[model samples]
Target: MTKDHYWPKALSKFWMDNEGKVCRLSSEGDLVRGAPAKFGVVGNHHYIDLEGPWSHSIESSFQAADDRISFVVDALNSLEAKPSNEEMAYMKRFKAGSFDSKSKNDFAESIASLIVRSPGFRHKLTLEQKAFRNEFLPDLPFRDSNDLKVLELRNIQIKYPEMIASLRASGKIIVMFSDSREFIFGEGFLQDIDGPNPLLPCKCFVPLTPGMAIAFVRPSGPYFSMPEVVTIQLTPNEVNLCNEITQIYSRRYIYFRSEQPVISKEFTDNVYYFLDYSKHPWMDGLLAAAVNFEDN
Candidate 1:
């Protein structure tokens, strides 16, 4: 008589028939005669070394394969929903009172397109300019430093008193650009005041690298009740300054508030002017003299 191999052909056929539906494989060797009463779990849990005829049984492997497929699908879906590192970085830059090159370019292009589309809008633009001058210009000191250089002129103007007052009240660090050169400096209040020396030492001047400029202004009172506006402007010269400054002061140490969204053209223009003057101190001095009418 031929010896019967322990292969379970009937169970293998049952698994192949119900491919999609859930099913369990029995640990018994066979059902026709020598099959055991209870089935055992397949794969690593049972430590059953499925081989040859038993390995080919579809019923023996379906459960494990299905579980693995489900896990892979869920993992892929999660990855799709998560934000990438680059996207996060861009969002951070927007929030931290800075504009990336692409954003700046897009903004400039949009403005240019608007101007081209409406030639007659020039009068309205002039009126808006005059209105801004009457309302907001008074608070700010007119650029008067002879050593400062005026790189580009925009129709916007800032109110100085409001800016300083807002800064002091908000308790945020105040960064100032010298009108005469591309040097940027910051100041912050001290935690403890001792009589006469209450105000802390002024922070070191950080040179505004050419082609880049940033200004952060908080208009609302403390508690961050109102959102701050961050303006960033860039030009060829400003870009150079940015490179030089970055080398001196690593970019990681630079911190500017990101909560405020920038709105006004005046703020953007001021940043441009600050960056220009910072690079050329001689031009700043000349600007001051010009304002005083000394050269004339």
Candidate 2:
């Protein structure tokens, strides 16, 4: 009976309005407001019916990660400025150094966990697994849905730690401060371009608050390489691009703190894709691969 928040409530609180509710633009093009605790949650989403009474431990771990990372987020949100790029580069290193290692690690793992445990990621995984089964193991007995759920949930638990380690080894953290409060994010914070694997994301972009975001940059990533830790300012165009990505990647709803006037029509125009699995944004690659396999 452990209700797990796929979108961690602690992080969602960042987008809350003065009324203590966040505005949610649903995939069906409906705008609604609700408390973070009620939204973005699923009953027993992370529960693994394992022995030793540790089925609820994953929720606890997520909560712990959220608690630790909230301080880092609050500190970032406090940075309200429009520094020039040169000044940003000069001051960013110092800003990055101010945070302790535990906070950074917790933030990293929290982002990874969110991606891994998301409903969108789970759907994509199911499609890929089904494709594998249909093509290679056609005669294999179909597994029970509950069994698969347990297996996936358990896999998330196992891979969570590994993902944190991978992020530490393969990527450097960067925080971006936005001059405009126009920034927004969704349940699917990281775009499809972020990575094919949730456990090993590359070039991930996560909006921490309307005024700030955090990213992980790989040495081989498209962006210019930087130090292990850095802070930077986002150009207005870059902020727009991030918001666009958020719109497409979000399967459930897009959360925002921007005023009602700023909730553009483009945000709700493509309502069909998210609600329909056949047209799911995350499935385009999988669909293309299936076509290639069939042709081959």
TM-score of each: 0.17, 0.73
| Best-matching candidate per lDDT | 2
- Writing each residue's lDDT as its tens digit, candidate 2 over 1-296 gives 77788777777787787888877777566888888667778888777665556544467766667776677687656543335353233333223323456766766677777777677667666666677778998998456776667666666666667666655553456566777546776665453323334344345567777778766644333332233455556667656666766675566577777443244444566431232322334223222221122100
Please report the TM-score between candidate 2 and the true structure: 0.73
Number of clashes recorded per candidate: 37, 0
For residue 148, give model 2's deviation from the true position in Å: 2.7
lDDT of each: 0.24, 0.59
Candidate 1: which stretches are off by over 4 Å? 1-85, 89-158, 171-208, 219-221, 224-296
Error of 2 at 98 (Å): 5.0
Off by over 4 Å in 2: 49-57, 78-98, 191-201, 220-226, 260-296
